[model samples]
Target: MITAKNPVHAALFLVLAFFSAGGIWMLLHAEFLAIALVMVYVGAVMVLFLFVVMMLDINLERIRQGFWSYLPIGALIGILMLAEMVVVLGSRYFGLEHVPQPAEFPAGYSNTKELGRLLYTDYVYPFELASIVLLVAMIAAVALTLRKRKSVKALDPAKQIAVKRDDRVRIVSMDAEKK
Candidate 1:
């Protein structure tokens, strides 16, 4: 996956990763997450990326120039992640016997319902905070993107609506030019 020269190939690998993740979610019985993964990554994001990659004239050599320079840091992060995973999974340091377990689900228990309940109850504050953060981000984006460009002529609706006939046109009496 590393050293993919073309953006298209990189996008294809991303799509493959998304599909694999979706399949993993399915195996975990998370229908909503799996479906969302498929819809968002496979259906929308990947398609958009493919179109962008195909349409835009990209300078691959320029992008690849700093690859080697950045590799060390990336390799360091990868190693740290690997170490963390090894600590979490490959080691029995924090065995299940030491941790408290939740009550077993009832026979007809639905993951969706449980998730909803947890979201509205235990995780409500964090969820609300996330929504507020997203709202602020959206407002900030709008404020940033919506610049009053001095070069472009912009009309105000109130000014246009309040216009009188004299404000727009005037009848003038001038000597006619006869050839």
Candidate 2:
């Protein structure tokens, strides 16, 4: 029985289902679509879900507080979004009488290779821009959390390297005759 209490397990189940479906799609020769679904939804979206569930300290009471107030608006937005998606999908059936499928690539050509080539060649600028954006985001995240504390002692690598053994260690033998 699937329940809300075990969201991580439920998400894992969903991820497995998606991966299985993607494999089936690949077997059916829809490699592009299967790879997209697996990479975007399974890899990115599901991982994000797992990370959020694991990392965030969720306040159930705060979430519930505005539920009643937002119910109508949320429902209305959801219905509108669903209607839009239905219309957009249905238009493909009604408007397009017949769309020609591209000829299959040669047996030697790989789908993954073709996708990589396209991303690197045709979409190079966009790909580079996306990478830069991600780099900036990473830097921003590090900057946000990074801080220096006066109370904490920090190791200086140069100082440690420069120190002689005698500065840090000592060995002594005392004469027993003095006692």
Candidate 3:
């Protein structure tokens, strides 16, 4: 996975890495999270990514035009983020004095159950808000994609429903010929 050189290889490697992490989570007794991660990231996200890559007409040259100008700033930001993460993770910086230690784990403890308890009891409001936000984002994406083109004769249900029967079916008086 780490041997990826190009963007496509990197994406594939990332998907593989997520799957591996999910497997690790499963082994650690977080089956719910493990399955969720695999299903969401591997099944949905990776497939969506593949579709986007395959379908999109990407303008590489346009993107690369200002790459050199942006590189320094991007690299600086990345370095700062790495430093912040290191500080947060390092005991020497954010030590025992700053935060409480994790509770001792009982033998045969289920990580998934613990996570569920914490999620419902402690973080339910945040969880609900996150879901609502995601729903809104999905709706927004659908609205954005649904552009009404003047060229196409698209039917509006409201307009169709409002139409009178007389307007649709016109009765014509014609002389019947003897056959």
Tens digits of lDDT, candidate 2, 48-103:
99998778787657656766788789889989999988887679674433432345
Return whichever of 1 and 2 wins on TM-score.
1
Count of clashes in candidate 3: 0
- By lDDT, the best candidate is 1
Which residue segments of model 1 deviate by more than 4 Å? 91-107, 164-179
Each model's lDDT comes to 0.86, 0.80, 0.80
The residue-level lDDT of candidate 1 at 158 comes to: 98
TM-score between candidate 2 and the true structure? 0.64
Clashing pairs in 2: none
TM-scores for every candidate against the unseen true structure: 0.77, 0.64, 0.62
The clash count for each model shown is 0, 0, 0
Model 2 C-alpha RMSD to native: 4.8
Worst 10 residues of 3 by lDDT: 95-104
2 or 3, which is superior by TM-score? 2
Report model 3's TM-score to 2 decimal places: 0.62
